[model samples]
Target: MALPSAPPRRRLRVAVVGAGVNGIAAAKAFRGAGHQVVCYEARAQLGGVWAPASHYPGLRLQAPRELYVFPDTGPLPPPEYDEEYPTAAKVYAYLKSYADKYGVTPCIQYNTRLVRAEPLYDRSDGGAATAASTAAAPGVAATVTVSALPTHAADGGKGLDGAAKGTAAAPAAGAAPAADAGVAAAVSSTGPAAAPVGWRLTLRTVPPELQQAEAGQCGGGGGGGGGGAAAAPAGPTLDKGGEGQDAGPREWAEEVDVLIIASGSFDDPKPPAYKGVQDFLAAGGEVLHTAHLRTALRRALAAAQTQKGQQQPRAGASGGAGDNGPCAIAAGASAPGPAVVTARFPAEPERGTEEGTEGGMEAGTDAGTEGGMEGAERDACRRFAQLLAGGRRVVVVGNGKSGDDVAAMLAASGAAASVTHLCRRNKWAVPRAFAGLVSLKWTLGTRAGVSLMRPLHPRPWPLGPLWEAARWPLLRLMEAGMRLQQGLAAAGAVPPHPLDVGLDASLHVEPPGYFAAVHGGRLQRRLGAVGALEAGAVVLGDGSRLEADLLILATGFRRSMPFLPPDLYGKIVRPDGTLDMYHAIYPHEIGGRSLFVLGWNPGLYGCLIADIAARWVLEMAEGRIRVSREQMRAYNERLYAWADAHFSPVAAADIRSGITVAYTWAHVDDMLHDMGASFARLTPWERLRLYCAPVAADLYTKVKATIPSERP
Candidate 1:
């Protein structure tokens, strides 16, 4: 293994943007290793996305407390840790307390926004023949630009956002590479003399989006991202650092050494093409990004803003008012209770006549060995429940059945209602896990009850269990449903499908669509297109009048390098509109290792998959590895051959847009293997050193060496 370089001797100044969980985690890690860390949040608190409770009524964590909670600290109410999922409010309070305990709150600068991050280059050393740059110190000149194009070259780096039309064009042949720099003086100025305070980041305050005034609404996207989705129609800008101003309000910018972008993430956003998005996608639609919506809602409900914040329980909800205190279980597996978890499926109105539920069951049994797998589904559900039973709460995120199943398992496992079942799409069946049990609770109507609702999927099609990966979950749900109602046909009521696709007959088909995450959520892989989907419906492209009271796009977003420019996943298209992000990390041989992507790689289980990426990031901090400036270009030369031969997801046009869904007993293992491979193959050594004092590398070593593994 490559070794970490010696620690920096001088006191380091580090700025971690987004005071959310990740930000808090990073700061704790840094401080533990002796670095001075300053945390910043655009809003007034440390919880990035978690601060405000949008769908808070039912919110909870999906992974058990063991995995979700940070290292070295405990959540408030100290999770039952082996009982039931906690509520969203509990999670909120727990996170707040988490930050407070670490003293992270004092260092956090809330309401301080960072719009853009320009690395300062050094110029004082111009007298030297070669450009002398110092990684240890900061005071520099010109903004060192870090650009990440697509995985492939020649594909226009400019994404397909509709508004940015005119400037996107092919480069003239033989044009001098103006985008590059050659003068030694340009590189020399950044030498050691100047102590850089922090990055010069831009922070533009945007006005709130249109909402019912009471519900609350605003906009934002993935953390560390620097691209704009179809810019909402022209509007007033919120002015920041109001200096000499223009007619409209201007955004704000801050200068700092390291920028830990924690903008959170974009749920599968719709491509520029999906139909009906025009309503919410068009002029008057509220650009309510996931977090903004939550934040705005909180602001609207503030006791000062309104009356005691009249929060309403979801469509169907009921159960124990909520967890009064933490459970008394230990790290040992299994929730401590007589109530074991099981999937509670929606009864098929007519059983097998519908294709989805029944069809999926037929497909599942047909695809696998039934005898050995008979109890596998139950086992998986049990483990899932055990995971929640350990947490203060369970947050069932994602767009599909996995989410539903997550909810189902929690409730049946004698789960106390601290569960938030978030279905990414409005159109779809509830997972067996949450369908009957939780749905019944939701229907019962009670505070601290199951909140069954879809967030909205923006993929072109509304229903998407068609994805191959979904078959297993859908089938499992099918079997479970059948078991619940013996003699019932294989299919559930498929009249409208999860998204009410072909079932227009049922007025319940409200258009926005379903979360593919349901059912192993494997169907997304089937519908996910490599290119903008062949949208049968159009907006400005065609005079199609569209409407989606809620238009959710299942179109995935950039997971890694959000601060980098927009490139779908890591694929950067050139001006000509062709994609190429080498190895899906760097654009090509031309891009520097310092200017590429990571984390954007989608994984199956949870975020930070096994903390492998954490290991890589820490290495990059210590300068143990060096990524080539010629990123994917160098790696692509080899991977292209590999793709031509194997046609893995990179080459396979199908399955490109979906998150991995093979969630059998070995699903988590699959995630571990995949993440290990990516991390093992391309070390983070190539990334530009953003901060000297950051000792992520040391922390990883300590954790890996000392922390006992909590087997999932």
Candidate 2:
């Protein structure tokens, strides 16, 4: 079962965008294959979505610890992380350790972004090469634009982009000199005469002061101050500069022989547009996507501190009797009314007394604030917690895993007066530990579990008909079991679709205490789209209104490749917003072998899938796995057709989603077969184990070990 040896290839100057799971894998793979590699990460740190800036308060891994590991890196250290599902911080640390172990950490250039990547070509033949010219002669085949991000840690620590505390920031390595800050091109060592076939990349350098200000505005919850009243901006708002800002970002350029995009799909946050959102913000109500939970929490604390500082009388406020105050509502509450305000603030004491004063000092004195900033911050945190558990009315949008986790977290913590969950429909959710005994990794994550489901194409002979006949009953039985286990029927949250249909659409793991919260009435579930927002209430699609102080949108992210040229982007992405990639890797229209995309496909285990994709890219680069344009087109057509038939309409509508969820093993097997790995040709015993054994990352160790190393 040995694979045919690939012909030795020339060393390539490879540039990888992103330093996340996929990016690290790509860098390690390319470097191992004797290619020059440098990875660009826009954030000050790696870990991708697990980075500190992206963590929500109660975030934990969706997959079990064993299934989330990188095969080459082995399992997460058990002694350090005892939880079956590790917290976000633990996962981030594990990723960092993995990157360091593989030598990928030092190769990463933090705080550097890939702005644009355009194909380059030679026009010496009196014919210019347009993006449409697939077979154009290659001589300097592409041009990429990159920018140096600000020198600031997103989580409010010391800047990791090469700046010391209270000191001026230094320019990133390879940045242009101060005088030539504007678009300077550094030709390859081969010179203009040679013009080797590669990408010419432009780099932008942001000045330290402007970068600091931008970081202050958008990062670390705006230093936990008055600016926290609003949700954190999705990204750095440097483009929309204020008075006294720098003229613009400085620019430079370089060249590379290859470009790999591993930015992944979670980059763009998709907060839906609601009517009167402006009014909501103006009224001091916060609207945040789940990605900005840290920011939202900080803002809540800051607003609470401000209100405590003011110590205004409740009677002067706009709302009716039992109202804490306008400022209290702004902090996180609605007035007592028929709108179902279930919590209230503790009664305030007379203002002049020390007991009523903040920090136990007399009312008019500055002595209460004398304990310094740290002490004040602690007070704010305590007050914010009280407000969260005792007074706030929160409305959560979407019912995906994130939505469920958030609602459950708030309810379990008693963080809201009324926790209302809004969604179009309920999704089927299974518990992490099936039947309260077997971990899902051993059930749904195993090949045996996948075998129970119908395949993308019809199987041969009697087995096909038998499977088809049994599938419906099996789905119904599974649905009934899950319904009883989750108490979905009792909570009136049972999904309308069967188990198979539900999996095809989206499968969620029930968050801890979610069903309990629902039954106990701490969390209320409402099925409808939000129609509008007015003052302190949310209007539902049926014209019913619910009092709300905070809104959290777990609506997920939008897939985009803004860094690619428009023509190339259009070719790779369909008009309907679905990706048009071949096996979710190569673009059909692109003729050259210089570009590759990783981490686009969603599956059961991200780290394992991404590592395999990286190895597949390495194989293609080394000429070990080759596909003709016709072959790719044919395969993609079949793939899309299968998706249309097997997936739910909602899931099939966007192929970039978790389309391979339950069938991830089949997808992995296909890729391994393409790579001609010996593991793909398993013995009878190994094959049996493959189907019956619990799935783990270590299963692919042999495949990884067999990949071609650097040629002498």
Candidate 3:
């Protein structure tokens, strides 16, 4: 590999992937660091997740625009919050504006998606050592050794010394076993022990030849200044499913100075990681993979590949862990910010009074059906002044963070929102109902009891099903949770600030996948009340049954950060085939620089972590901090160790069977530690991974020698 131009003696070349919010925000930081940064995105649009026309109907911003807006931007003025929440268009507009302000638009290549992101390590600096957690960091010649956990009991919750229900006990050995442990332990001891282990992630991998997302239309590899072959043509998108889709082979570009992965949890396509990913990993890629990976991801890619059909692809949104947070932990209530009012018309005090259905539900009553449409009975006009002077549930129906807050408040206040209760958890809305319980993610999964819903089926699946999308994100959250615990266990360091949290789910939608019209992957299925009903807690397509006071759909959006797949570090994929990316950033094994997620500052409030994320990326790009391999690992270990000390209490609880659960508080809790000890702190999480990588080189051999197999 020759110099793309002799690596300009005093300059560093950074390959900024994606121009979405996360990617763009990162670009700002990179620019600040004074690096020659070139950003690429697949779509012709600059806003990764903010592309408007592609957003679904009635879509509103997940978090308060104020909290969610990029770092240096201001949300809509006061009057904006007085009425309704910001819609996807509103947010997207804001995103575009943000780009304009930060000078991000110019540096971004709209149609160029980062088909691949890699770290172009300076070759002169010796290549990575095989399986060595102890190797000296890149650029730095000194060897740094990270010791095991300290003896201090790490846990920041109600001191374990008190023995209260919310206390953080020592890390228990009963944590999850390897991913291939055969059957998954019940979601909790209570979830249907007999409920087939974890759901199989059966990806109906549409054979390669016909995939979307892969169509290189964005002028990909047009040439150096142009984009060489990266953008040859476009492909079929999921907007046209199961058809003549022509996508590219899983693309690769692992060797780069900086890598950014922009695909989010449920949307963008992820053709199975073939040779490229494996080779990159084998050679040490600084990839940062996310749990948002979902079936639609592939579908989106497939959609992109549907070139013969010449169909367009999806924008950024997906379906999973929206505003309500993934599990009970994230669902716990935070202080109420301005409640974005949806319907603003006055409640007509009648059962059915048709208001305005022009563009959106007029702020008025729509003939009260059950319980006077919850909040519509009170204060609809004051919420959003821009809306009409009436009230409607539609404003609150779609799961906006504001709506969830309002609904949760109503539920906690001992009132009914007219939503059906998930029979097993004995809670309303499957997402947030049982949040208060320590680990009762869902009562069924926590208690050793049988579930009302029977098994969907069972089989060997490398990837979980797309139907179980809500629960998939938890898999990675759990893995990170486990490694945090394990790292602390070995370090023996006492956890300093443990968090006690709860989660809730308000994301409700009809299932039994079928669509009346499919243009751009938007399934006009008989959704909402008309399409389906929960047969036994699980939402099913019935069309005739619509029983509930409210329905809040928590639709997650698309995302992609830096260095995914091959260009990755940490224990993202343990030998057990489990993910261990601690804090959603660095890997548990090798602590390389990383980019985690960001959204509403609700569950976790550490602007510092966000700041740090922005800062770290910038520092790495500008050479302010040359992250050596060991330094990277050590940093990860230190953070995980601290994360365990601070947030284990919330995750330790058990979740329910067949229900998606997440420790929102715990996830955010890590943010707290990150806020304080970011970058500068050489905590255990970082040290261990950095040193462990080398010392444990041939890590498997070391383990095998210590514990010989009986078969031998």
Residue pairs in clash, model 2:
120-141, 120-142, 142-199, 203-252, 388-415
Residue-level lDDT for 333 in candidate 3: 24
For residue 690, what is the lDDT in candidate 1? 9
lDDT of 1 at 310: 58
What is the per-residue lDDT of model 2 for residues 545-596, given as tens digits with 9 covering 90 to 100?
A: 9888778777765556655555566767777766666667766454345577
Name the lDDT value of residue 301 in candidate 3.
37
Candidate 3, residues 14-52, lDDT tens digits: the string is 445445555666667666556545555444445433343
Which candidate comes out best when scored by TM-score? 2
User: lDDT scores for all predictions?
Assistant: 0.29, 0.54, 0.27
Q: Per-prediction count of colliding residue pairs?
A: 103, 5, 178
Look at candidate 2 and tell me the lDDT of residue 391: 65
Predict model 3's lDDT versus the native: 0.27
RMSD of each: 19.2, 12.7, 23.8
Task: State TM-scores per candidate.
Answer: 0.44, 0.73, 0.38
Tell me the lDDT of model 2 at 375.
43
